[model samples]
Target: MVESSHHEKDEALAPAEMLALVRDQQRSVEGQIAAFVPLLLVAWGVAWLFGLGALWLIDGMRPGLTVPPAVAITIAAALFVGAIVLSAVLGARSGRGVRRDAATAFPAIVYGCTWSLGTVAIVAVGLGLLANGMDAALARIFFPTVLVLFAGLMFVLGAAIWRAVPMLLLGVWIVAVAVAAPFFGYPAVLLVLAVGGGLGFLALGALSFRHLSRLRRPLAGGRRG
Candidate 1:
């Protein structure tokens, strides 16, 4: 009886079983990688939606009541800062307990640094242009378009790293919005970012949540089986 039990335990899984196991593992890994994406997207969506929307309202792009631009800008800046802080905390938390070789960790480190450095560069350049007599109206357009374009490029790079099609699509959408916002001119450009870019992020976040739910269901069913 002991020998018979040992033999059974040592037997290889059937081909179908092996394939199913592989697929389950793949889903698990995908879920882990994607787990934080929806939250991040939603957070940014809120920031862009209400934050940029407030800016749009103050810009007097349409004929209606308006708030102080300073007030709108301050609220937007606060929301953006909150999002950035949350992203950093969540990103760091997600990597905990994951095995990290230099090859695997290097890209993430570099990518994080790129965001910091690129943001600084944008600020410096904007300030330099302003000091050199760039018009206030132009400055408003320059800052948002350049910042949004930079974010889009970073998203594309992240998609390449993770092989996530949804992320890739989001990046493409952001790039399109940034490119097109300029044609709408000032204030109106803000509306484009608020409505188009903001709504896009929220929509993608919802879809991603649904996808993640579907991914989890199979894994749960497999475990039960």
Candidate 2:
């Protein structure tokens, strides 16, 4: 009886070891993604979506802003570089989780709808700014307030709902642009938005939307190790 019981324990240990080994192999495979190309992809995502329109505000590109062109350029460049590093690190990191069903897919699907509607509003705000010029009260109120508010929302959403690294960073930059806008003027602020906001979103949206499922797959398995 003792020998028989010991044999059963050994048999159970074999399958457990096999599962652990397979999980480790999966993590190894996923770690390989943290490379040069993935960083580029992350960089692209950030620039297009969030930073595209805002870039017009940067110095040299437009004259209305108060800050010197060189200073503005330096700030913008730093943000770009930082965003790329952050996104690449997040993307390359891997995890495991249970696979999703139709219900689970809804969050990603619905998130875009708000973004779509908000885009129209964002475009209108831009048009308003351009059409109204610097003197208009609405432009004064709209650009800083609306943009800051929007950025905050996106930051929260990116951090909370989507857990999107690019979006979260984009949100931070957006808030920064809003703070700088009143001091620098729309020209400089707009440039900041373009480099960080428009470009950030475009790049992030592409990367997150495309790779989110693949990235989430491992997390669902509940086995990071």
Candidate 3:
């Protein structure tokens, strides 16, 4: 009877040990992820802001398109600050832990907003350049690039939908458009690709931010039942 009792004790210990091991692994991963995600968010935000800045500069240079540089800068800065302010004011997270999710989601929003803004700028420039009788080579560079960009965004957004099947299908569709666009002819092909891709990223960022917003509280801690 003593031997049987000893065997039961050993079995119980193995499970406890296993649980401890798993928890340790989880802690390590979560710490590393927490460190890296916030940095990525800031980088993405800066890049998006720069893209808009470039767009503003390009437009301001053209005659009919010209706007006050100070005005452009002010507007862009406002947008950037607005986003930061929104996070601070609107985030519902009840704990610091859930804030990590918001931080992670912020990059997605930045990336999406970046490309969407890029698309708008390109469209404006394209029109402005057409009106100004600019060189054909410039259009050759801008339009197709914008299309491919849009397509890429669409793919990202689709993935961000947080559904495996839909994201996978969206990935396929995005790839098909990207590959086929070059054949459609310059500018047109690029536009197709950019719009398709850009849409995905835009959608993804929105969904991710939405999800993070909903997660304003962390999971309750305790042993599972």
Candidate 4:
């Protein structure tokens, strides 16, 4: 009789143990993301600000005073390359202890590839339209379109994977800014990317870091659950 009772008790505790394991796994994933948040934010913030500033300077404030095409190309290349390098370094460093199962790894790879390809495609399309001498009205829509597509994807992916409210909100904010950019015109679009978007990212990064800090203290005290 005692043996049977002990067997039942062990079975009951098995599920609870499983539940605790899952929660810990999720928390660990979140923590790793938090560690990398600051680096990613800083890299992107610098890229947007620097790239927009370069574009504005090259394009000039008044009409017909634009810098040479070579100068603009060089600036864009440098900013993007630097941002890419910084992000790679941060990812390698912060992801050290994070467990990567197929379930998590596959989604991350897909999201990253999609964004990289989508951004490149958008740039290519814009350049093609400009080269073909597309009308001013159509040309003006290009930047906004790129912003909407990029931000929309981010919002969807973040909502799906992390279910992070702040990330979702940031995506919404970016999309709204992009939609409003055309009304304010080109200079305003630059300001939106550099100042508005950068600030939003920085805020999200800070929030993530704070959340990780809070979780650490509690989890450190004892095994959660």
Question: TM-scores of all models?
Answer: 0.87, 0.47, 0.34, 0.71
What TM-score, to 2 decimals, does candidate 2 have?
0.47
Each prediction's whole-model lDDT (CA): 0.88, 0.57, 0.54, 0.70
Give the distance in Å from residue 194's predicted Cα in candidate 2 to where it truly belongs.
5.1
lDDT tens per residue, model 1, 103-210: 988998898899989989998999999999999999999999889989889999998997878888988999999999999998899989888889989999999999
For every candidate in turn, the CA RMSD to the true structure comes to 2.9, 9.3, 11.2, 5.1
Error of 4 at 46 (Å): 2.8
Cα lDDT tens digits for candidate 4, 11-65: 9999998987787777766676676776676666666666655665555456677
Collision count of model 1: 0
For residues 1-225, could you state the per-residue lDDT of candidate 3 as single tens digits?
999999999998999989876875555444433333333334334434443443345443557765566775576566556656544443332224444577668766775577668778778978898889977756765565555546445655645654445455556655666667566554344345445544543554555455444342221132331
Model 1 alpha-carbon drift over 4 Å, by segment: 1-6, 14-26, 61-64
- Badly placed stretches (over 4 Å) of model 4 are 1-29, 60-76, 135-141, 144-149, 219-225
Best by lDDT: 1
Q: How do the residues 36-91 of candidate 2 rate in per-residue lDDT, one tens digit apiece?
A: 33455555545433343333433334356545546645655666667756654654
Worst 10 residues of 3 by lDDT: 216-225
TM-score of 4: 0.71
- Global CA lDDT of candidate 1, please? 0.88
